[model samples]
Target: MRETNLDNGVLILSEKIPGVRSAAIGIWIRQGAAHETNADTGASHLLEHMVFKGTRTRSALEIADSLETLGGSLDAYTSREHTSYQARVLDEHIPVALDVLSDLVLSPSLRDSDLSLEREVVLEEIAQVEDTPDDLVFEIHSERLWNGHPYGRSILGTKLSVEGMKGERLRELHSESYVGENLVIAAAGNVEHEEFVDCVASYMDTVVPGVRSEQVAEPSNALAGLELVDRKTAQTHIVFGAEAPPHSSEDRYALILISSVLGGGMSSRLFQKVREDLGLCYSVFTFQSFYRSAGMVGVYIATRPATATRASEAVRGELERIAEQGLSDVDLDRIKQQVKGQVMLSLESTGARLHRLASFALHDEPFQGLDDVLSGIDAVTCEDTLRVAAQYYDPGRHLELRLGPS
Candidate 1:
């Protein structure tokens, strides 16, 4: 991998993998929901949609056809800490991919007509979230977990917020957050470092350097207990979570191992104990959401409304067990291998590498070789896992959300 910084403050990173016929390119901006005010909630996500609507030189259809005709793909997504626009194409179409991506980032029209249509599209998206019980529960959990912070709000924003969004407001946001200093352009697979750098440099030369927005304030650690929202669904969706280490913590590797052993797969403790043995409702798992300054670890289970209490008890039992006794050496070794294998397998894809590069750049995390990552996972000791579990897995600190028939 190679990295270059343009005078305009745009950072470009590239990795070349031989024998691959395709390349993945991504433009990442270090701004998302965390950067917005209460009045301008969801502007980042709304801007993501508006960018693809049109550009100064290409209409929406033209933007779509430009890549589709080449058997390529273009996509974008918004997250709490950042937003990404990515493309995958045959090596020969690298230039075309770069051109389209650059245009979307640099010259989006953000027209009133497009805004009017996209607003409804975003509104429908907000409704879709409300309609999905499982999704709505997590959003509710987040609101209570982060409580009063921008991070607590739904990424889709509220209906009223979207309705109030105007073309001029979104354009103002675009100008402020989408500047040169906050941008990272990354590409991997079947590309030369210098050539990719030059390709990006040409299009980004006009971007004026600007300061990045302030970082999000750290969230309070006060626990909000069991929040129940009534829905007429047959099954109940529950989430239990607490504060965990951020993306940059030294204990991150240990936390990953703990999360895997607790609920990562079919063989995980949650799946084996809750689903396989007790015959709870089918889906049960664990997840971790890591941001620059804060993170969350949680368990999710869906079961018949009658069994909600039992399922919750079973999850709590496992959490207490791990916090008290920790994992056995054999279990620790096994989960480390699982994590190492997953990381190695994912790096085989150019898209994954593209994202990894951009993310590492944004967080100022040093790029570790695959072997180094595997080594980090392997080096996590039973004692290390136990320490993390004791610190982060206290049931008293957890916030619970349940959505079901009341």
Candidate 2:
């Protein structure tokens, strides 16, 4: 693993198992929907699509052709906290991967024609999410939890905000927010350290300084209560959320342990009780989404509307039980193993590895190694899990959201 600071942000380069023939490269930026005002709510996501439209020297088709010519693949995504543009290619095509990524990020043309088409595409994407209860529930969950914060806004962007997004808007956002100081390039797999650094460093050296917009203050914790949204469907979508620690918070590990006990896997309390024992729903999971400044823990489940209330009650019962009584040594050991296994298995892929490095670095932290991660998971005693449960998982703090038939 190699680490460096270019501009203000850190870059982590790891060349592992160099004999493996595939590689993944990603440019991760810290700007996202959370940084936007209401008018610019979807700028980050819109900017992601615009980058693919064309660059100053390369047409959209040429950009696609170059990568496809090398038998490689490319994709991008914008989330609440970050945006990533990435490509996966064979070892011999690392140059092509880095070149295309640089062109897209640094010199995107943001043509007028492309802007109009992508805006419509994003609106269609938003409509599709509106039609899917599972997807819609997350937006609703954030809305109720954050309660008028930018973090609650949909990353796909509101239809009105998206319609107003012209080519100039895209250029403005790209120029202001996609700064080198907030950017990091991460690569893994089948790479020689010196050659890989030279390939990426060459392009990054030419990157001009860009400006970042001011961040809004953290959301007011006044909405620290329950909320619900009612919808009509066959299966009710449920989400329970509460204030939790930010990324920099020391309690993050405990929260991870808490999430593990609740819905981390098939052996988890919710999975065993709700899905395996009672046959309530086909899907259930828990998720944590955090900013450097604030965070939330969310529990999600899908169940028939007829039994939605029962599922809600049972899930709540487990939360209260765990808070009050904690976990058995057997349960704690199993959860630790599951978390450790997930971390190890996911790092096995070049794409996943690059993503992990980029994300950790963006938060201004070193890549916590696999051993460090496993050790943290191992050190999570039953007391730690219950402590998080009592502090963050109090049932009264939950914001309930249900989308289905009444």
Off by over 4 Å in 2: 7-12, 212-216, 222-226
Query: Local distance difference test, per candidate?
Result: 0.89, 0.81
- Taking the tens digit of each residue's C-alpha lDDT, what string does model 1 give over 18-133? 98999999999888888888888898999999999999999999999988999999999999988889999999999999999999998999999999999999999989998898
- TM-score against native, each model: 0.98, 0.94
**On residues 1-406, what C-alpha lDDT tens digit does candidate 2 reach at each position?**
7776656343546656655799998888778888888888898999999888889889889988988888899999998877889999998899889999988988898888888888888999999999999999888778767888877888988888998877787787788777766677888888777787778778887666565445446777625544556677778998888878777676787788778878887877899999998899899888897676688896899998888889998889988887786677887787777777888998888888887777676666666888877887787777877777788887787777777776
lDDT score, candidate 1, position 215: 75
Q: Model 1 RMSD to the real structure?
A: 1.0
Least accurate stretch of 10 residues (summed lDDT) in model 1? 215-224
Q: Once superposed on the true structure, which residue ranges of model 1 sit more than 4 Å away at CA? A: none
The lDDT, on a scale of 0 to 1, for candidate 2 is 0.81
Alpha-carbon lDDT of model 1: 0.89
